[model samples]
Target: MKKILFLILCFPWFGMAQGDGLSSTVDSLYREDQFYVGVTYNLLSNQPKSLSQNGFSLGFNLGFIRDMPINKRRNVSIGLGIGYATNSFNQNLLITKDGAGGYTYSILNDSQTFTKNKFSNQVVEVPLEFRWRTSTPTDYAFWRIYTGLRVGYVFHNTVKYSGNQGDIKLINVSDFNKFQYGLTLSVGYNTWNLHLNYNLNALFNDQANIDGIPIDMNTLKLGLMFFIL
Candidate 1:
């Protein structure tokens, strides 16, 4: 996991350095009226009830500028995109019992007790965001900062657990569906954009308490992008 995160953070610097030369060529091409397409690698935001448990995610986007200029330097753009994201956690590590418990289990040479109702949920979603640029084609070598809002739907939300006597069960919360909505904020340079997103709805519609405590998850995401076109 550490290695995965290390690469996610470092990969951009590597690409940024290499893009310096390519930016010149890209600039010439876009001046004649063209489109841009790219893929973004997003780092899920770590927040309560967030869908970003997976730590790493990717998205694809494409858009066209209207040839109108902004600040006499940058151009305005609108685009459509779809993304897939998920959040997951290890149950055994978070669950616990008071030894006057229902079940006993061993994880990584450690013994722990847990109540029967042990479950965790991960959500997979897709969002569409509207993008606008704030930089010009000539001033900065190749950079633009953009921001927008996105709407997302949760396609899958489920929980997994092992009952007493080692009986495993996976529960599908039917109430949880591909129906979800959210907003996104991002800033990009030329072909790369950094993003942050938050889900506006609660994970559980029933308002049911989790472990005698309420669990309300608002998703968060951090991502990096690269133009593909």
Candidate 2:
């Protein structure tokens, strides 16, 4: 009779131990770091009326995201990442320095219209997001919505213009904004997400003028993001 009692107690304990181990394994697999790469179509906003966009400009981003769980269920997390991004603008306006040491924008004349006229900048960026997903350890595909802010510093700037008149390449343009901050969002399912960003700051400082109007252009981007775990 004692043996029968011992067997009953031991079986329950063994089952409980197996259940705990399975739970731990699921948690470990579910809560791993996520990495992402994205491509964007950049659009310049608040631009001068005379300055028209020629074609679709591009931006690229890559980063590793650390997810911090705040709830017991672990479906929601705070994501923080450090990333690098580069943005290009293709437009009809030319940026140049005026005699007073301020930057000036002029409408490109026919002679100045070249095969390629673009301004681009590279930045080191930090992103913070409140992330929510319907994800589980056994399921790798899920729906997600992540909204966040990004802060960046422009480390490099370049202007390239090629035409019949000549080819002009300028590095580290003085008028470009050095510090930039923006709002960002991503929403979708599985590995693909629709991403959007709108810069909160002007692309140039007060020292930049377009036809005596202070140039206050901002940047807007729409793109696709791919997440990899």
Candidate 3:
């Protein structure tokens, strides 16, 4: 009788151990790349003939993305994110206000000397992405390529100038376009990724001009992107 009872208890314990082993090995489905941060070298694009970039334009970006997998393999997905960005562009263009509540736009000639001339904007941005990766539920490192569009609303803008005209600072000077949109691409493996952004619209509105020429300047940014779960 004791031998039969011991066998019955041993069988139950063996079954329990087997169940635990299977549970530990089977991988569960998971989400990846829900948060991200980046830094970029901002470049002025579609510039006028006399206009040239005087200093390096730089920008920082940080955001969160909602990762949604479409395929059964979970390798193809869509991402939507919201983020904040601040950018600065340094150039020779000058902006000043007129007596009639209007604004004046000018490009400094070589004869004109200025210590500082630049403009900056802070924006709230949204990003939509189509993402593809070689990632599985069990893998921690994988290759990914993501392409997307980003739209931004400029909440604050400023222009600063210091030179022969003395120090002049203007706030929300009325020429910058409050709405901005751009195309974005990110590609890499593991934690390091290369990111690119190109703005499709001009940075300023129609009122900004230099000697009857429209200063329809846009921006291009190239940088690195770091993603985290």
Highest lDDT scorer: 3
Worst ten-residue run, lDDT, model 1? Answer: 101-110
Clash number for each model: 9, 0, 0
Error of 3 at 229 (Å): 0.6
Report the C-alpha lDDT of model 1 over 1-229, residue by residue, as the tens digit.
4654565455456555644545444363243123333334433232234212322234434344333332333355544545444444432323223355332222311243334333333333333334455444433334455455555555554444444435455445543434556676666664456655655666445433334443444445455544333
Off by over 4 Å in 2: 1-25, 98-102
TM-score of each: 0.51, 0.84, 0.87
Cα displacement (Å) at residue 51, model 2:
1.1
Ranking of models by TM-score: 3, 2, 1
Q: Supply candidate 1's per-residue lDDT for 200.
A: 69
By TM-score, how accurate is candidate 3? 0.87
Give one digit per residue, the lDDT tens place, for model 2 in 82-146.
99988899988776656886556777976665898899999999999999998777555678999
lDDT accuracy of residue 1 in candidate 1? 48
Query: Which lDDT values do the candidates have, in the order given?
Result: 0.43, 0.80, 0.85
RMSD in order of candidates: 8.3, 14.2, 14.8
